[model samples]
Target: MHGVVQHSLIILAVLTSLGVIFGLVLAYANKKMAIEVNPLIHIVEDVLPKGQCGACGFAGCMAYAEAVVTNPDVPPNLCTPGKDPVAKLVGDLTGKAAAAVEPRIAQVKCAGTHTKAVKANEYHGVQDCVAANLLFGGPKSCKFGCLGLGTCVKACPFGAMTMSEDGLPIIDPDKCTGCAKCETVCPKKVIAMMPIGAHVRVNCNSHDKGAVAKKACSVSCIGCTLCVKECQYGAIKMDNNLAVVDAKVCMEKCDNPTCLAKCPTKAIRQAVLGIVPGNEETVA
Candidate 1:
C-alpha cells in the first residue's frame, strides 16, 4: 500500500513539473513572438464607421486605420462613405490634409428597355449579364446596352442598386458609396461614375454610328456629333463616334445649351427618363 501511494505521488509530481515547464515555455514564446499592435490603429479604427466598403482603397476600415496610423503620407479622405465629417476626424488624428470629398454617383448609360431595345435572340440559359453576354453579345440588338440581368444589383455590396420592372438597374444615391463596384462588374461598361452636380450627360453607350444604332434601340446615341457641334462652350467632344460631355467645361460654359434641342433622334439628352428636363436626375 505504501509503494502504491509513493508511485501515485511520483506520477503527480512528474505531471506538475511538466505543466510548469510548458507554462514557462509558452510565456517565453509569447513574449518573444507576440505582435505589437499600435494603439493609434485602434483609435483610428474606432472613429471610422466600419462600413468595410473598400472605398478608401483598403480592404476594410481596419486596414485603412493601420495604413493611416503607420504611414504619414496616406491621405485620410479616401473614405467615400465617411464623407466630410469622417475626413475631418481622420485628418485631425493623422495630421494629414483632408481633401474635400467630391460627390459622385453611379449613372447607368443605357436607356434601352425590354420594349425599346429590339431582341436579336431570346436568352434562355443563365440570368447572369456577363454569362448572357458571352453568348453572341447578349439578346439585345444594342451590343453596348445594359443586359438588365441584375449582375450589377448583385455586385453592389451596399444594397445601393436595384433592377426596375422594365429591366434596368436603378441606383439609390443615398445608399451608394461611389465604390465603383458596379462599374467594374458590368460587362457592357454601361454604368459609370458621374458627379452628382453634373447637369448634362450622354445617356447612351452605343457606338453603332448614326442609323444602325437608331435601328437597334430608339434612344441609342447615333453618334452624329450634333451635341459636339451645338455646344457653344466646346464642352462636348466625339470619342469612338459617341458624344462625350466634359462636366468641367459644361458647368462653366453651358449657359445656353442648344445641344439638348439639336439631337435629331433625342439621343443626346439631359440624362432623364420620359420628360428630358434641363435639370433633373436621369434614369437608365
Candidate 2:
C-alpha cells in the first residue's frame, strides 16, 4: 500500500511539473509569434453584406473584404448584395473611387414551359438537370429550354428561385444576390444575367428557323428580324432565329413599344414598361 501511494504522489508531481512547463512555453510562443492584424481588414469587413454569396468572384465575404482592403486594384463595388451603399463605404475605407457598377439580375430566356413544349421522351433516371441534359438534350422538344428539374433553384443559396406552375423557374429579384450560380447550373443555357431595370427580354431560346421553331414550341423566335427593322436605335439583331437586344442601346434609342406589338411569336416581354393595349398577353 505504501509503495502504491508513493508511486501516485510521484505521478502527481510529474504531472504538475509538466503542466507548469507547458504553460510557460505557451506564454512565450504567444508573445513571440502573435501577428499584428491590419486595421483595414476590420473596416472592410464592416462594410460587407456578410452574405458570403461569392458574387465578387472571391471565396466569401471575409476574403473579398480582405482583398479589397489590401489590394489597390480590387474594386470596392464587388459586393452585389451591398450595392451602391457598400460600394461607397468601401471607397471611404480604402480611399479609392467607387467604380460605377450596373446592377444585374438573372432571367430565364426559355419560355418553353411544360404546356408549351412537347416531351421528346420520358426520362427514367435521376431528376438532376445536368444529368437529364446529357441524355439527348433533355426530354423537351425544344432542345435549348429549361428541363424543369429545379437545378438552378437548388444551386441558389439565397432561396431566390422557385419553380413556377409551368415547370420553369421564376427568380425573386429582391432576394437574388446576382451570384450567377443559376446561370452556371443551367444545362440549356436558358438563364442569362441582364441589367436590372431593363425594359424587355427575348424569352425564347430556340435557334431553329421559324417553321421549325414553331413546330417545337409555340413561342420560339423565328429569326424574322422584325424587331431589327422596328428598332430606330438599331438595338435589336437577329442571329440563328434569336433576337438579341443591346440593353444600353435599347435604353438610349428604343423607347417606343412598336417591336413588342410587331413580334409574331410575342416572345419579347416589356417587363419595365406596361404592355400596349390589345397585346397584353402576346407570346413574343
Candidate 3:
C-alpha cells in the first residue's frame, strides 16, 4: 500500500509540473504575440450606438470602430443608427471629412389592411413571417404584401415598428434608427428605408398586372405610369408593375404634385408631414 501511494504521488507531481511548465510557456507566448490595439478604436467605439445591428456593413460596433480608425477607405458616416450627430463625432475623432448623413426611416411599402387585402388562406403554424412566407408565399392574396406576423416588429433593435389594428405595420419615424433590421428580416420585402424628408411615397409593392393587382389588394399599384407622366421632374417610374418615387428629386423640385391625384387606386399617398404615428391629433 505504501509503495502504491508513493507511485501515485510521483505521477501526480509529474503531471502537475508538466501543467505548470506548459501554462508558463503559453502565458509568455500570449504576451509576446499579442497584437497591440490602437487606443483610438476604443474611443471611437465608445461614441457608437453599440446596437451591433450590422447597419454599417460591419459585423459589430467594435469592428466598425477598428475599420474607421485604421482604414482610410472606411467612412465614419457609415453608422446609420447613429445618424448625423454620431457621424460628426466619429469623423471628428478620425480626422475625416464628414458628409451630412441623410436621415432615413423605415417605411412600409404595403398599405393593404385586413379589409382591403383578400386572404388566400389562414396560417396555422409558427407565428414568424419568414416561416409563414415559406408556406406558399404567405396567407395574403398579394404575395408581395406584408405577412402581418410581427417578425419585423420583433427583429427591430429599436422600437420603431408596431402592428396596427388594421393588420398592417405602422412605423414610428421618431423611434426608427434606420438600422434596416426590420427591412432585412421581412420575408415579403415590404419594409424599406426611406429618407425622413420624403413626403410622397408609394404605399404598394405588388407586381401583379393592373386587374390582377386590384383583385388581390385594393391599394396595389397598377403601373399606370400616370405618376411618371404627371411629375415634370421625372422622379417617378414604373418598375415591375409598381410606381416608385424618387423622394430626393420630388422633395427638391416638385412643388405641385399632380401624381397623387393621378393614381387611380390611390396607391401613391403623401404622408401628412410632422404627424406622429398613433396620434389622432393633426399637426398644425
What tens-digit string does per-residue lDDT give for candidate 3 at 44-106? 999999888899999999999999999999999999999899999999999998888888888
lDDT of 2 at 128: 90
Write one digit per residue (lDDT tens) for candidate 2, span 1-284: 99999999999999999999999999999999999878888878977877666789999888988898889899999887787888999998889899776778788887787777788899877989999989998898888878989999998878888887778888787787677878987888988888887777888888888888888888778888988898888888887779998887777666675788788878876753222211225523
Q: What is the lDDT of residue 38 in candidate 1?
A: 91
Per-residue lDDT of model 1, residues 223-245, tens digit only: 88778877778888888878888
User: Which scores higher on TM-score, 2 or 3?
Assistant: 3
State the RMSD for candidate 1: 4.9
| Residue 132 miss distance in model 1 (angstroms) | 1.9
Residue 33 C-alpha lDDT in model 1: 100
lDDT of each: 0.82, 0.81, 0.86
How are the candidates ranked when ordered by lDDT, highest leading? 3, 1, 2
Model 2 residue 260 distance off true place after TM-score fit, in angstroms? 1.1
